[model samples]
Target chain A: MLGDCRDWHDVSVIEVQELTKTFGTVRAVDGVSFTARPGEVTGFLGPNGAGKTTTLRMMLGLVAPTSGRALINGRRYVDLERPVVEVGAALEATGFNPGRSARDHLRVACTAAGLPTRRADEALETTGLKEAADRRVLGFSLGMRQRLALAEAILGEPRVLILDEPANGLDPAGIRWLRDFLRHLADIGCTVLVSSHVLAEVEQVADHVVIVARGRVLRDAPLAELVRGGELKVGTRQPEQLRRALEEAGATVRFEDDRLWVSGVDAEQVGRAALDAGAVLTELVEERSGLEHVFLELTRAEMGEAG
Target chain B: MIRLIQAELLKIRSTRMWLGMLGLSVGFALMGLVFYIALAGVEMDGREALPPVTDPDTVRAFYANASGGVLFMMILGIVGITGEYRHGTITQAFLVTPRRGRVLAAKLVSYFLFGLAFGLVTVLATVAVALPALAIRGGSTSLLDNDVPMILGGTVLAMGLYALVGLGLGALIRNQIAAILVAIGWVQLVEAIVTVALPQVGQWLPAGAVRAITRTTGGFGGMGELDTLPPWGGTLVLVGYGLVFAVIAMVTAVRRDIG
Candidate 1:
């Protein structure tokens, strides 16, 4: 099974093509389309109610598409010969019976997927829930339940993982562990599509990002491209003068928060432009437009358009 | 499909709810047996007097009525499916078996077995109570030597069929509280009223079919008057109801979105 992980990309791609889902009068997912490739962590970024869960559900065939379809491995999820062995998913953290033990929970999934029951113990060990395996979920904290869900997801040792808001109840340490765990899965060539409303949770681990808001894909690109586009900030006593110099240097400059927002230029150019402008510089730094900034800009723009 | 059924059975086994329900089912069976034995030969209003245990029909009725505890089995089946929706485990179930029909079929099969088990246990419990009480009351123990075994088998089969019906109802009505209320209400209140008011119609209902299996003539809920179909006809009608409900449940389960 481990050896089979290497070449999964040939057949394990999660392809959503013009997928749309409408609930009554509400278009919950509006022609959303994206592919989560194997051997990479695809961060499904969205705010709450952004149709992230709905799209994932459609891909897993838990929800029917109103007009379009989502295919896994060039076949619909329902058409998969062995769905669990090929695609493992944790759609939510709370799909567990309160009275069931964590181990029993995974075992049930394992049994359903035709996997050995011992895989339940293996999954528990992988998710750091081994010690609490015998404990009923009724007494488990939210973090524990989240871990149990992950354990259930990995029961089949699937090559593809789709998790929806998997870090909802984790503490900081648990979140860090999850980050490393996902990275490890992707490193081992599993296609990981994890959705999170929190940008920072996905920022450290995701190789690619698919950002959605209001039932539409706002942006889908490499994480590095989404986060880094060379925007610089130059704070000076003469903001107008620095802005004019930076604009002359062929950079888009905006005056905001007592600073010159320079884009389309490097830090070195900004420093030189400021020096030539005869402006006394107070602060000069490359403004790293992290995922947080990009996400806000995209979602806020979406909100503006909607309004 | 077999794996899915095993998974469903494992789910029921993992929870304490089924064990508690099984205990309650046996208790109800014991209670009904005691009541039947105590009331033997006594006359009740609006009906024939309770026949003595020596009568073959009376003995068969005693064995069949013991499966009245099978009501808990029906509830078990309802909770089995509805609990998945209640806890959001239907998502997990569907994810594991993307062909939603397979999952529904698996649930129907597993719950059917559970219903059989419940019926079997209740019958055994009732027999344990009936044999001693009958011997003490000077009733012939030879009653078990007659069609008793056949009646017990039919009662167990009826219980399993009832479970399928319950599973179908639960799948159709995903809400646990609402489904349970419908099961109890239809079996207890509505069926009883119909059996009393319209015997012909009651004879075709699920409880009437079950009574026919046990060769019990009086209407469902042990009230009113009904002329039941023959045993084979009862089996066919119950199977028909189960299949109809199972099909409806399967189609709905496949079509509806998992919210």
Candidate 2:
């Protein structure tokens, strides 16, 4: 590899700093920063309009940032002599010519990067598109198109792959194949940045996660750190009163509708508090914090704050 | 640069649009032959009814008149570039080659080569069909004449420029239908009306200049005592259009988001 992969403790393949993009008065990507290290799949988690695509576009030099910078291999994407060989990207699935065969599509990419034509055929086979390599893309399903896009991305065996919503329109088998393929790419020292609104799918593949909301980064941490604590939901007739009691007892209490959400407190403590307060507890359950729940909780809190 | 050009050529070769355009070029050449035969038949029946057809210059004029169908080939050249934008393939193209300037350059070179080859073939086929009809009508004309070379050169140049213009339009609009409409309306309808109704102003317009240099007398009949720019000058004007539009397209392509 041209870049450091063994020295993962020091190598940061991509470093985005305070990136911002504005469309008129609305900021699409506002002051977002994150780093993707070598040999890891970093999930760019965000909602539909949370600026994931804009940030990825800025990173790839497709859309220039209004402020700050995104560097790949310690250099801007445009500054790289061989962009396709340095950072392969598949922004959207339909970004292909329906009239072109899959092999020809990869051939164009390889030619652009000054790679050997053999790489195109190799990538087609790797992506499981060899059987359909000669078929025109017009007849391809969305899943097939996604595979073709992936094949194009990996044509030059780029060190870094930036894919936006790569799992969209894929069957279970295709998704599993994608997960395994991306993991395999990472295993070979490639830095993968996969963006999607689907948290569970990304959580399955990404080693690290960066959550963005309202054009800003809310959290960036390893997957283990993100899904560390178990969340306990306690529903009571007097949720406000229950929240105060939990806070007084030195517990982190969050109130939502008629439910009292208590983190840093176990279900037993919640039951004990309900018994002590002589309150009838209709519901008390300890729930695991999956990526989806974390995403919803983080984005919902950000939305409430904005409102 | 060579690799990029090869990639672009490969892309064009793999598309059905290229095949369709080739077929259309041959069809236009056949139409030219039909026109030449019909004109020759009419001329043999009554020589005094139409313009004089005596000298080699008159024979060249006859070929030019019959080969007017070749103008459609130029339209096909324009569509070639715009078709990619309309089909949403430019995204894949740019992703493959992030250097926007180099990609545009490759497109221009590829389109120019294609237009040149197609234009040459169409002209050759038209002459092959038209020369026999001219000989039957007692008119002496050789396809290898000096005037024929100049005419073919000018037509090829015109086709190349039009293709570039279409490329520029495709980049600016990013929609196939809109680009085609603008190209067709400007080249065929708008220029036809303007050159006839307003000769002085239309001479400076891009399509008018191209038509003026390519066709001889009686092309724009309403432009009385037509004073037009030289063929090279018209070519320069078309090239200028291509460059300006291409630059705009390049900037927009780099600046805008892919969505």
Candidate 3:
């Protein structure tokens, strides 16, 4: 889906190696590791209280990790000469002084980043907040605040973007817009690492997914690869006969409600086995699993193990 | 570094609190000057006779008391640091300039300047009221003679230095309300009582150091003047307090994680 790639270099890569953070007696983030490359949207997916925010904070140097590192382009965040020019982070929507105007907020960020103040206006236009540019943030809705946060994040046009739950307060239309925005950013070779508790939102926009549970990485892979292999659901009158034939054909078959849930074989193989068994097929469809199912299953399994 | 300082100044200037604080500061300075002028040379039952405005000491006292607005400058400095945590903007501040030390250093410089501005306005207001009132009250307009200019310079320095002290305190105590309360309570009550009760010990405190800067003598409520350090000595003590607090704050902040 990425086009118009800008020959992006490896300097935009984000590397988190064995990062961990502990608060008092609670271990918030424990040994999390992942890498996000340029030109791809990496979704850091997890449930609430699963250390996603803590990890992101550590990555941005807002929090110190116990025993590991989160490096952007082989340098620590605090070591970057001009951090905003290289990486932009919008940790939350509430990171605003309510009394300050929206334009002034971005202008502060722009000034800190050593960018021209006019970029603040450009970012306002980009985020569709030009009209509210002069208004104090106290009057803004949560969705507008989220938009303003996004606008601030992109003020420097940094090569790397780290946004935590960018779609939290957005409406459906706003979510769609954010999805497209992220895709456009990735298309232009910006490394985007977005964290979300909602799997569907990330599933729509993330090229790569890093699923975490209880402060541990569960599954990390491309979205396409994770959702590629799925079970096939075969409906028939003779469920017992279809199960026997499918098992004999080296397929794992389970009979449930007059249907056979078949795995370990493709639809074509299942059809051939049904024909040989003279099973009157009612429905045969590939149940390609979405990230939601895999996410639920992995997180559930992890929870079960912990419990 | 300059950009960071500019950002810090912008952050302060964009807020309405600074303007309100400025108004209050100027008003407080003028109010104190007018009250002192009205009461000059007047005697009350069970109290010492008021010294006339022509008295060099009384005139010096007017300039010294003119710095009542220093309290607001301290608050401005405190808000400069604590507001970031209160509003959750420190995260963005750090993100924009990852080196937390630089962010704090910028704040220290900016708040110092802000406090200086507040001091300048209050000083000008004091001169406006003191000169006219002194002239009408048959006092010499020799306000610029002798230690008067020294006292004025010291007042400005006290305001600027106190701001750094406030910034340091705010950094050490991130809670906005708690820091503000501690600052006000200490300056207005605890320090006042301590200075009155134990002149030797109180003279070493931050407030006493300020009195030294302005060469303020005598205590509240007809109490006798406590022994104070020389003006330069007071400036040294106050600067030492600011530096110590700032160094401690920087050390703690560099290690403390932002939650």
Candidate 4:
């Protein structure tokens, strides 16, 4: 029943079907299933120890599942003839040898995959690591290591990319560069799956999200849908009157940072309320519900220090 | 398979271990040459007539006194895989080549050649020492001896076999320092104590088998703590140790999750 060959939108780069992993009595991943389709930056979101890494490992065939399967390109990863060219993965940022230079590290990957040695230099350029290519990884900053890992992951120019916590050690500027790079990757039809615990990090890059908690998926929905319910942020000179006015207008208002967060109301409604209340309005904007808020709400009950 | 081997070679090409092993083998042999040259005729233990190794059976017996330091090949083998685990790079290695059986096989084969190369270098150093020492002691070099080729070949094979055993140990024990300690303890203390206490059983063990493999130049003398198997038998036994480790690794590695 795999007949949707021509429809690129219907194709899945990653599909995990009822994947479960047990360590003794502890079930790390309990029948988890999710899909990451092509041409989208899908964020695999979960709290710490929420089976995210385990599931990714299982997908890449690094960890065996207790039951069920994880498939990439309609086949198991082990069955892939040229895994590097088809699936580029960077599970850990610091997986390169410390003694080897960054260029040498990528060369090893290129050599193993039988890709041209030139691809190593191309990858170095892609990750903006060309200046530090000759330096050994021992001296690399965490951000530099993450970049090297990205370079190695993209060495084979793979169609699908799987990265786990790709931005754990980046500065603000580096994070911005990463967001743009991943967006560009997805724009060019390369499926990108990046797993992260932080919401603000993924919210800016992820087009789709699969959030998990306590070894179970809490939601598998588009980012826009998950963060649909938001508040109208109002910055006013008179916070008390704006809050009272917004409240009188059947809106729930909370004071935050010299502004009234008007929930159950739109930006236009907040502006009209401020004008009607004769309060000076400086800034009024609709603040969408952040993935962090949605994530916390969905996972609060399940996050009882279980793991 | 060739690419995998090349990749494995690249992993260790710049490590200090290879240079250290080279220095170890050559240094030990140089020290032996110095000792034999200066004191070949000096009275020791009050036996004026007998030299340190008079008319010894094989070159390794000489190297046993000079430098059997190639015994470190097994340790090198352990570090090969364990180092990957220690540095958390096995994840990348496996990701690039997901069929772990292929990776394991490639490791063993690649490391076997790696071990063999060092084995030859160790022998070359030993010979370099022997050439001068023999001339100084008024003795003929054993390079042209008919048995030299087989003994040297066996010595190299012995080294390669130790590497296989080391690879197995690394697989069974993923921790680098722990695996290294076990390897050292096994080769130095355990085997020595066992050969001394139980010669019959120890001869069938790997260390005893190594004697047969390395001392096949005509007679047994070097690392000869116990009565050893024939050269061919020792080859099989030494190889058996590597195969046993590989068999155990093959069964256990896939069961546990890689990092």
Off by over 4 Å in 4: A1-5, A233-261, A270-285, A304-307, B32-41, B48-60, B63-67, B144-147, B216-226
Against the native complex, each candidate's DockQ, computed on alpha carbons, is 0.81, 0.53, 0.84, 0.67
Winner on lDDT (1 vs 2): 1
Q: Looking at model 2 chain A, which ten-residue stretch has the lowest summed lDDT?
A: A1-10
- Tens-digit lDDT track of model 2 for B76-155: 54565556556656666666676778887887777777767776776777677767767777766666663666666776
TM-score of chain B of 2: 0.83
- Across all models, the iRMS values in order are 0.8, 1.9, 0.8, 1.3
Residue A35, candidate 3: how far off, in angstroms? 1.0
lDDT of 3: 0.85
Where does candidate 2 chain B have its weakest 10-residue lDDT segment? B215-224
lDDT of 1 at A36: 87
Candidate 4 lDDT, tens digit per residue, A253-284?
88877777778777778888889889999988
Task: Compute each candidate's TM-score over C-alphas.
Answer: 0.92, 0.86, 0.94, 0.90
A70-149 per-residue lDDT for model 3 (tens digits) = 99977889988878878878888888999999999999999888899999999999988999999999999989999999
Q: Compose the digit string of candidate 4's lDDT tens values, residues B1-259.
A: 8898888887777556678766775676567545545655567677542244345442334544322654577778888888888888888788888888877888889888888887888777777777676665656566656345556677778778788888889889989889989988886888878777887777788877766665632222224445667778877888888899877766666567874
Q: Estimate candidate 1's alpha-carbon lDDT, on a 0 to 1 scale.
A: 0.83
lDDT of 1 at A21: 88
Each model's lDDT:
0.83, 0.76, 0.85, 0.80
In candidate 1, list every pair of residues with a backbone clash: none
Candidate 3: DockQ?
0.84
User: TM-score of model 2's chain A, to 2 decimals?
Assistant: 0.83
